[model samples]
Target: MDIQRYLQHIHFAGTPKANLHTLEQLHRCHMLAVPFENLSIIYHQGIHLTPAALFSKIVEHNRGGFCYELNRIFALLLQQIGFQVSFISGEIRARDGTFGPPFDHMALVVTLDQPYLVDVGFGDAFLTPLKIITSEQQPQASGTFHLEHDGDYYSLERRNGDRCSHAKTLYRFTLQPRQPEEFNGMCHYHCTSPQSHFTQKLVCSRPTENGRITLSESKLIITQDRQRKESTLHSHEERLAVLRHYFNIELNVQAA
Candidate 1:
């Protein structure tokens, strides 16, 4: 799986032998190093959901990717590291209050004695894993996150600025293990379809201790304290510069 290459590229210093603590550490480390981005799709490049393709895109090319690509490969790595990882399809709820179909996004539900909603995909949701128990309050670097029971399902919420609001569920997880190649069709649709957000804008994001930094087209957006800072990007070079300097992404000059 070229696991060592990934760990070294991401600068994940932890040992390969897996355990709960190691998983926790990898969760945070991956978020910091590999960004959650969708720039390839925006630049008219094809997106593949295979382990090789994803590893090349992320670890080798030093690029970032969306949920399907990032989480799919992350899930694979977790499996290779001897963790129980399952791939589940998430329905993205946009800022405009619209919901998409299942497989609109992808995330991992990891089981290690206790389960954790492990996602390296969502740009800036929870930096750490969230306990899957319905009654547990999972503390995060950003804030306290809770997952409440809703009959057979679960609802995720986050405490931000003294207000607790609904956070989108990545997926309803099962113990089923999935391979990254299984999601190829869905990934292709997201990268190519006009209805897909990836095709609409060039976006790349990486989590920070405070919030997250997102680059959309020629704009750079940083959020902290629930407040957003945005600035226009005059040219593609400026956009590429922001991505390379800030996110550690090095893409082909013409790609941006």
Candidate 2:
């Protein structure tokens, strides 16, 4: 990995040390610059989990990707910077109060003074790394996030605010270290299976300074200071324009 090029890709400057402060800055910078997108699936481009493929897509080509692609490459970057990082499997919690199968998602656990749950792939979620503490509300610009400990499993939960009626469980994960290849099956599933949401829609989103901008299918949704305004793309040219102007993605393929 060309560490300097990767840092330049994310616009990260200053000398980096494998400590909490550097980790936090790197995490935030990555989130702001790189989007959580699934255009590869939409365009019928294969999603490869290898480091070279991920780096080429995200850093070289100025593109973003889903969890498997984002998190795996991020883990490699962290390891190169001397951070002790490990891949972990997360079972996504669906709206129906059920959890998906193991390895439904990939997240990173970085150990500094303590372990921090670092995830850049989870769109519009926590911006900074969350310390691996139980039941402590970690308030972020995006939302109020917390973790619940259940024996060996830990559930990451989020709420709109303190006054929100209910907390939504984002995903449940264990601390058990995993290899990147362990997530291959689910990665392929997400890219190929019709049941996977990635295959069903076109989603390219990233967090801005105030809120988030999401290109979901033909709709362009921009949320700023908690106020959302949505507009529809009337044509493929309009959709392509939105992609370039807002998301900085210039694709040659026909819009979905």
Candidate 3:
């Protein structure tokens, strides 16, 4: 893996020491730089999970990807920078209090002083890495997050007081280390299955200093300082402009 290129892609200038501070800085930078997008599925372009292909698409072409592409390649980059990283599978919790299949999402566990759950793929979730313990609410720019342990599994929850009466469950995961090849079946399923949300939408989102900007299909939503401004694009050209202006992606899908 090209460590220097990956660091340059994330626009990180901090030290690469395998410590808490470096991990926090790198995690935050990656979140702000690359986006969480699934435009490949929308365009009918098959996504590749290999490190080389992901590096070329993200770093060279300045595009973002879903969890399978984002977290897997991120693990490679972190490993190159001397951080002990492991790829873990997460099952996303639906709104009806049910969980998706295993390997529905991809996350990382970096072993520093303690284990940290690092993810740049879960769109508008935690900006920095979350500690792998069930104690202490992890504060983020978005909101306070918590992890609840249930026997052998861990549930990731976000506090949603105003929008909902209870804490919202984001996903459930386990500490079991996984190989990249293990996710290939679900990765293909996500892109090909009609029930998969990725195959159903064109979403490109990234976090800003104050909030986040998401371009889903023709709608452009910008949330800054707790205020949201929504707009609709009337033409493909406008959508392409938004992709280049906001997310820094230049793709051939404008004509699709």
Number of the predicted model whose lDDT against the real structure is largest: 2
Tens-digit per-residue lDDT, 165-196, candidate 3: 46888999999999989999999999999999
Candidate 1: residue pairs that collide: 37-65
Q: Candidate 1 regions off by >4 Å? A: 95-98, 163-182, 223-228, 253-256
Please state the error at residue 59 of candidate 2 in Å. 0.7
Give a tens-digit lDDT track for model 2, residues 1-256. Answer: 8999999989899988899989999999999999999998999989987778888899989999988988889999999999999999999998898999999999999998889999999887999999999857899998888899999999998888783648889999999999998999999999999999999999999999999999999999999999999999888888788889997888898766
The alpha-carbon lDDT assigned to residue 126 of candidate 3 equals 92
Q: Any residue pairs clashing in model 2, and if so which?
A: none
RMSD of each: 2.7, 1.0, 1.6
Clashes of each: 1, 0, 0
What number of backbone clashes does candidate 2 have, counting pairs of residues 3 or more apart or in separate chains?
0
Give, for candidate 3, the lowest lDDT window spanning 10 residues. Answer: 159-168
Q: In model 1, how many backbone clashes occur?
A: 1
**Number of the top-ranking candidate, with TM-score as the measure:** 2
RMSD to native, candidate 2:
1.0
- Screening candidate 3 with a backbone cut-off below 3 angstroms (N, C-alpha, C), the clashing residue pairs are none
Alpha-carbon deviation at 219 in model 2, angstroms: 0.8
